[model samples]
Target: MDLFWRYGFATLPVLVFVSFYRMGDVLTLTLSHPLWNARGYSLEAISMADGAVALFASMAGVAIGGWIAARWRMGWALVIGALASAIGNWVFAWLWDTPLADGSLYLAAGIDQFGHGLAGAVFVVYLSMLVNPRYPAAQYAFLSGFAFLLPRLVAGASGTIQKVIGYDGFFVMSGALSLAAVILLPVVLRARSRPSDQPEPAA
Candidate 1:
């Protein structure tokens, strides 16, 4: 269990990098496209607002998700998080083709941010529950390394992918990947239900 947890955490940077890269590329492409671009807004302004909103929303979601994880089942949280992530990605993708006024873009940005924020919060809580306090030093080191390295590696090709596949395709692919995380939830829940030397609470 510990090994599995460590490996997962260690790969997190890669996952995040891929996710963010896809997100940024899709956003840029969508907002800059002549037919899909938001009315009365510059690309830079849209990017800045979207980025800022995503950051704040993610922060808040993490705090809330952490609290929820303490009392809920980790498997359930993971499933919900996966679904939320997929939904968020879908919403962002939808924005690519949505024709709207300036204020409508703001609303769309808010919805996108909210979905991502909730997903982040639930995901953090799920991951945290997997850690064992006894081997904190080694585990933490692995997590830290992954946190810094994976994103850099995975995000590198994001721009190229966007150029090749376009915004809609990129977003659909990303959403599918995020949704795939849910497949592991049942396995995780079964593992948790087994009797252990030190039985821990769910989540």
Candidate 2:
């Protein structure tokens, strides 16, 4: 279990990637305020978009994300997923100004939900790969839990940040959080190309 955190930290960038992998997802936490209070989007609009539209859209995203990873590699899926989440936040920011009757709300909701679905599928697979078959449960818990650690902490301040900067600024800030993944991608990819710290081989 400690390997995920304790492995050769100096040489391996895995810890950094692991920590920042889903950082942009915190944006989802900030969404309710802008959509509900700031924008006055109705619960009916929320249901219409998050219910049927999200169901199909998220399903499609998961399928496509899986296909992309299969066709090229897992990294591509991760990169795309990170970008999707960031872009989704930006769309929501823009949607804040859109009139609800214009149906733009549905489009923004679909994009955000689809991104979550896509990111979630690949992220689970990636986390599983990082686990040891010997102690999969504990190791996976650490990695998965660690991935959200910083995001959850940062999310504590989300409301304050939004109030100070306004909805659009807050959304953009959330989208900008993707820079963590983007900036670290090269190092993470390089680390992947090399041998990863893994479970000891069976005798």
Candidate 3:
């Protein structure tokens, strides 16, 4: 605990990852049902868009991300996933109120799902990498626990944010927060490359 407190900045990638993941969750949870109701999309249409199109696309994206993670560094994968997520959210936000052909909503949902799928897989890998191998169990538990809790806590504010900014503005904020992950990529790569980056055993 003392060591972690002293070198907190070394945890940049994980913190950013949590933020990115939460933003995506907030966007999905806070708006999807309400948006469907406002847009007059039947529950069946919503099911198709979320359950079918998004689900399949997300699965495909995870597979692709797994392959890419094998071939490339985790940090790069994170950057790509973050950008894709941001773009996907932006696309949905842009199309929120526009008249949609039967296929358009599915496309938007698919894009968002694919981005999230990619990011989700890579995020776990990245957090694992950031933990000290010597204290793998405890460090991982700490990081993972904090990562999970903080995001959900902040996400609880989505309702309040939606009331203040409205859906479009809320979505735009989500996308923007996701993009903040991109800024930490260089730091992640730098930390990974350092000769002393190896994790030390817990005292």
**The candidate that achieves the highest TM-score relative to the unseen native structure:** 2
Q: lDDT for every model?
A: 0.53, 0.71, 0.70
After superposition, candidate 2 runs with Cα above 4 Å error = 1-6, 10-12, 192-203
TM-scores for all predictions: 0.64, 0.85, 0.81
Please state the error at residue 172 of candidate 1 in Å. 1.4
Candidate 1's error at 161, in angstroms?
A: 1.8
Clashes of 3: 0
lDDT (Cα, 0-100) at 102 in candidate 1: 52
Instruction: Give the alpha carbon lDDT tens digit for every residue of 19-127 in model 3.
Output: 5554664566557667667767777878898898988999987888777777787767777777777777776676676786657778878888888787777776776
Q: How many backbone clashes does every candidate have?
A: 1, 0, 0
The TM-score-based order of candidates, best leading, equals 2, 3, 1
Worst 10 residues of 1 by lDDT: 21-30
The positional error of residue 150 in candidate 1, measured at the CA in angstroms, is 5.1
Superposed on all Cα atoms, the candidates' RMSDs to the truth, in angstroms, are: 6.8, 3.0, 3.8
Candidate 2 lDDT at 62 equals 87
Model 2 has an lDDT value of 0.71
